[model samples]
Target: MRADRLVSLVLLLRRHGRLTAPALARELEVSTRTVLRDIEALSAAGVPVYAERGRHGGFALLPGFRTELTGLNHDEALALLVAGSRRGAQAFGLGSALASAMLKVVDALPESHRDTAAGAVQRLLIDPETDLLSRRQVAEEVPDAIVAEVRRAVFAGHRLRIRYAAVGQSPKWRTVDPVGLVTVRDQGYLLAMRSGADRTYRLSRILAAEELSEPAQRPERVDLDRAWQERSTRFRTGGDQVTVLVRLDPARREELVGTALAVRAEETDADGRLRLEADFQDSRHAVWALWQLATSAEALAPQWLRTALRDRAAAIAASYTSQPES
Candidate 1:
């Protein structure tokens, strides 16, 4: 809002319109001569700001005059610098570049403002939970351009061309339509649709990713929530189903179904027996549920479950018999 800069800004807008000298001087709180001098200064700086001598005159940004980094309040600028530093550090191969960008912005600030920015950065702590470099070999310095480009591509619905590597798989180049970006434990994942199915690829796995010119058209009727639900349901189905028939003292039957491993309750018979069914992702997951009521447990329908339990119990007994208490 200082007079000199305000005059320069007013003249910068005049290229698109006309600002009377009086109005320009009033806005800048300066004399008409000073406004003229400011305009000359702008022209000297190679700015396209110009003045027109006419009654219908105001100020405007000339055609194709796009402002960059304009009108950022001090607090907003500081917040941006801080947030970008944190997120960029967490992003694959972009940490150092963000820090460098922040330094450049700080250097451009006024002495006092620069001190404030530097102090803030010193006081700020950016502790990412996951060491992103652990998964891949990246040169220590990360570039800011990668973070900016990836963010632009993710939000614009663009397909990405990536050279990606997976665990136990060779690195390969593939084209994928990115659906969403997932941040987990400080690591970033690009969730995408590949071969018409949802897949997750780690950002670190990507040797390179470039956005395509054309926007990717996602499935017209894709239900994201339903897709997540179906995925979880399928994973549950992949595990073994165990049916537990417990002859609890009728009082304990209710408590038995409340066991941790009980996925759901089938029914309780008249004779105080509870028929419980549960699904386990693995024997460990199932064992966790059954172990909650293992003392009062019975294998009711699936005779194989009973045999497995007996075998485990026999193994325990045999182990004890084979080795006396040392």
Candidate 2:
């Protein structure tokens, strides 16, 4: 771990030019004393590190010094190349940085391994634009400025004011303490808190944003994975959840179950159809999901859902039923 920290210190200086002891400690998540010791170690190892004095002083490496650390093996290089082919980085506004990092990784490879790795990458593709059915994967667009401001607030631990357009509601401005950002399936979300209440806002739905001067009231060390999991559990359990009983063709059973929040029970009927009791987010969510199966599925319970599907089918049939032109 000390060796990793030493290498990281060198890389940090190489990237940022100069940094104070406290700044380096903060970035490296260590103590100022540790940073000072690391500096001495690097200099003793002939790394040419130097320090400046006074209140505005900091440590810096000699000009034009860069460590040629090419430690990636062949499989590792290909793994990185395949990961770089994904569009997930674009969702977090790090597309260009990812591209630049990939180039550096490729350039760092040994001359003999570079061509073979580059050629292997061509045989694999990640996150293609269209699937087998030819439906395009549409990625939401969050303005670069908004993403930057939100990111700044998240990293700086500051509060943010955002003009958000919530689904089915008018756009309104709100102040939130941003906990973290998450991008899933090309959609970006700002997981935050408002007046001590957990709030999740879609990045694309943010019309505008401004990082506030006030410090955010949040935990000093945030466990983002835990926070996200807790929020997801609350959302899944708190909403107007509905249990839907549906009869679907055996072949379409997987499709229905795949989209539902959970399957409560499942059994095969005498007619060889699959009968499933599934949990959905709400009535609207259930209707939308079931409708996608078209004639291959039928809602069996909550009489209301049946009526809704019947009414919708009738409306569609009426539209198609034509009278002779006069």
Q: What do the candidate models score in CA lDDT, each in turn?
A: 0.60, 0.86
| Tens-digit lDDT track of model 2 for 1-326 | 89889989999999999999999999999999999999989999999999988988899999988986366543344335435436656766666555666777889777988999999989988788899999999999988788879988998899999999998999999999999888777888899988988889999999999999999987788787888888877887876999989999988888888889889899999989889999999999999999999999999998999999999899989987998578
lDDT by residue (tens digit), candidate 1, 101-210: 55656766778677777778778665543465564433323244554455556667887788887888999988888776554445666667876777777776677778
- Local lDDT at 210 for model 1: 85
Candidate that would win on lDDT: 2
Instruction: In model 2, state the lDDT of residue 18.
Output: 90
Show where candidate 2 strays beyond 4 Å. 1-85, 320-326
The RMSD of every model to the true structure, in order and in angstroms, is 11.9, 10.3
Residue 324's lDDT within candidate 2 is: 52
